[model samples]
Target: MDLEKRPREGSETWVDPRERPAGPAVRREPDAPEGCLAVAIRIPVRIVVLVLVVPVRMLWDALVVAGRFLNDTLLRPLGRALLWLGRAVFVWPFVGLWRYVVVPLGKALGWLGHVLLVVPLVWLYRYVLTPVGHAIAWAARGVGAGAGWIARGVGAALGWVYAWLLTPVGHAVMWVLKGIGAGLAALGIGVWTAVAWLARYLVVVPALWLYTWVLAPLGRAVAWCCKGLVWLLSTIVTGIGTALYWIARILFVLPALALWRWILTPAGRVLAVVGREVWDALGHAWRVAGHISLALGRLLGTLLRWIFVEPVRWVYRSVLTPVGHVVRDAVLRPAAEAARSVRRTTRQALAAARESVRQARADFRRMLFGEPRQPQPVDRREPSGREPRTLGSSTTALTKD
Candidate 1:
């Protein structure tokens, strides 16, 4: 091949072939493996297996054996011993404290509180507070009854006055006022009717007559004269407009219409027909393109289903899903059960702690305040009204007792 004479001129940079010395051609060599790969290949398989695989297998076996031995011999016993110790040292003591010591103490305190505090409070309320309250109530009732009797007498006098004297006077005054109001209303009505009649005759009638007889005719004559002038001007304007319309129709409109009807319409029809044909061709092409696009889409969908979707689905269903199941069974389920057990145990411990705190608080209160006082009901029923007595007399009688 004439390499120098070839399309070298098309490029921007040029070189003089005569001035440049040609170098030796670089002969391509066949690719060979690297030195490391050659060494790996040359090494004995038995030696490689002995150096790399045997130790790993031995380590794996040792780990398995050691784990089994530790679990069976050491871990299980240790776990059992820890569990037994925890129960004996912590759990049993807590249970016994709550059951025996805390519960009995609470019961005794409750009973003692009821007997010492509640019984005395009940007795004092019944004897001392109840009598004092009754005396106060009786004194208040006597004062209220006296005031009520006086009020009733005054109200009766006022009611009698209103019913007999004030009511009749108010009715008579109202009757007189109603009669006066009726008379004044009738007088106003008669005066208003008279004024309306006088206004109709004196003002409204004369105004109607003047408008009917003189002003209406004068207005009609003036309107007619103005209408005649307006009609004449409008007629002249209409004639001018009609003449211009006809002139435009003859000069421009008719010719334009003729041009459009004969030349443009036919040409437009031909162009429209050509356009319809071209549009149909383009539409057909677009339809074919759409079909091609649809086919390509279907093909792409099929390819995606085969290449990506089906393989992914298969991996999920066969590999990942089974692995998930195995993980759940081997790791997650046991971990979940352990968590639940721990949570239940923690809740029980917390509940017991809370109960112990409540008991301790009650014991502290009993120690400090000498147990809780119970409320006693006071007898609130009134005694017979026939046996009314003063506070001083009753107190003296009690002192003597």
Candidate 2:
């Protein structure tokens, strides 16, 4: 405050320089109004829309155009190419599947057809061939049978012809020769008989008489000498016989005693053994006999029943029935008819017998009296008293009549 040096009444005094206010304080601008800020934001947004959005829209439109062009041009061809490649990839596998599966199935079906055809063929061959072969064999057998029969017949006929024709001729020739031989034998036998008789009567008779008369005496003398010698020889032989008989008796007795001593000691054991053997043999024989007897009895019973009873029964049924019928028809009926016929014939014969006897009596009287005395010379004609003509002339005349 000084009026220049006077202090100003209301003014404050300045402080030290250090404490003085710094240079003028910088003023800060005032915050804008909300409406104004809004107005400014709207204006920038409008400008940004004009500047960015229009260009982006134009670029998007171009991209869209480019994508549509790419879809139309490149993508369609690529898709078509991929589809073709996929089809190419699968085609070979499909062909291989058809070859592996379908072709094998076809071959299997063909094999089945072959089996079906072959099986029937084999069956037909078996069935038809066997029967046909059998039939052919039977036909061959029949042919053989026929040939055998023909051969047998021919052989039989030839044998029969030989037997009947040739054999009989040969037998007749042999018979004639046998008859001639028999005659010759008879003649020879007669000759031998005569020679034997002549020899016995003529030669042997004298010889026998000579032997009896002469040789008998000589034989008796010689026999007397022989008897004397025999008596001497008998004396010598008797001495030798006595010695030999004693020696033989001693030898034979010794052997017999030895044999009895040796054998008789074991006789009981031997007999026991023999008895056992005999018992076994007897038992065996008994069993065999029983078996045989049983078999034989059965056989005999069967034979008796078959041969005797069965045959008799069969004969009674078979033969007797027919035999009885035959007897009735053949014998009884015929005999009955014969008896009736005989009776009828007898009756008829009896009825005709009187007339026959009368006729026979008349004939007998006529024969005895040289003709019945006819009415003597009824005077129908003159009696020619000439003797009757000779039998020869009358026979001739009767023969001419």
Candidate 3:
């Protein structure tokens, strides 16, 4: 309520209505015009141009479509046909050229390909494989040479051992054989000397004594006896000869003459008549001998015919014919058939018998032992340690146990 500074309304305290105070001035926006209405009143040229260009663009599109249709329907098809006709006109000649020239060129190219592939392989064989093969061959040759050297060394060593160790043994053996031979020779000489001396003493002296003392006298006595026997035989032969001559003259000669004169004359007449009768008898005897000879000849001929011809025929017919048949039927054919049967049967029987025996053995073993015997399995695994039994000394002790 202290009115000490009351000021007039229009004065500086009222801050003239048109002028702001000094601290803060009032800001006034400029009055811009309504540009949106003006923009709305202006005509849009893009819309007019769009309206006018649409019909013209449609007419141009129609012309393009008409051109595509004319090409597709007539012009393009005619062009394709002309190109096909041109290809057809040259096709046969092209094919002929390919067959005559190009095909041959292709074949040559294939051959060249093969040559190209093979040439490298051949080069590899020459430069790489050949050298490797030669190296292998050389290695083998070296190994063989080493083996040969070893063999030669072993042979030389063996030869040296034989010369040093065995040669003396062989010489000693030969000397022992020579000594034994000499001893045997000496024994044989002594035996021969003893036998010769014994023979001289036992046989020669006795033979000489007997010859001197007894044999000479016996020889003289035998000679004297032989001379006496010869003299007696000559005297007896002379006496018997003289007595026989006297007897023959006295007794036989006179009697023989008298008897011949008395009896021979009548006997001669009778003998004449008997001789005439016996003339026919001699013929009869000759006829009988001829008949006997004929009978013997016929008998011998019949026997010969029987032995050579008839008996051979009989043997062929009776023995050989039946024997051949019997051999074919009973021996040969039956033996072959029986052998075949026996072989088949033997195989089957052996198989069956083996099976039976095996079963029987299995049954017997099972019955005896209450279980079939099984073979002990062999251990393939490496042994962990040696068993006490495997030790030689321990095994010897175990044997006593």
Better model by TM-score: candidate 1 vs candidate 3? 1
Q: Which sections of candidate 3 miss by over 4 Å?
A: 1-179, 265-401
Order the numbered candidates by lDDT, best leading.
1, 3, 2
Please report the candidate that would top lDDT against the real structure.
1
- In model 3, the clashing pairs are none
Tens digit of lDDT per residue, candidate 1, span 175-286? 9999999999999999999999999999999999999999999999999999999999999999999999999999999999999999999889766655554554443344
| TM agreement with the true structure for every prediction | 0.31, 0.23, 0.23
Q: Which candidate ranks first by TM-score, i.e. highest?
A: 1
* Clash pairs for candidate 2: 1-6, 1-7, 1-8, 2-5, 2-6, 2-7, 3-6
- C-alpha positional error of residue 349 in candidate 3 after TM-score superposition, expressed in Å: 89
Please give, for residues 1-401, the per-residue lDDT of candidate 3 as tens digits: 21113344443432334346566665444333434432232223223434454555545555776799899999999999988887888987798899999999999998998899988899999999999999999999999999999999999999999999999999999999999999999999999999999999999989999999999889999999999999999999999999999899789988888888889976886666455435533443344444555566578779999889898999999999999998899789988998999999999999999999999998998888897458997754334467333544333544433
Angstrom error of the Cα, residue 193, model 3: value is 2.2
What stretches of model 1 exceed 4 Å from their correct place?
Answer: 1-262, 282-286, 374-401
> For model 1, how many clashes?
0
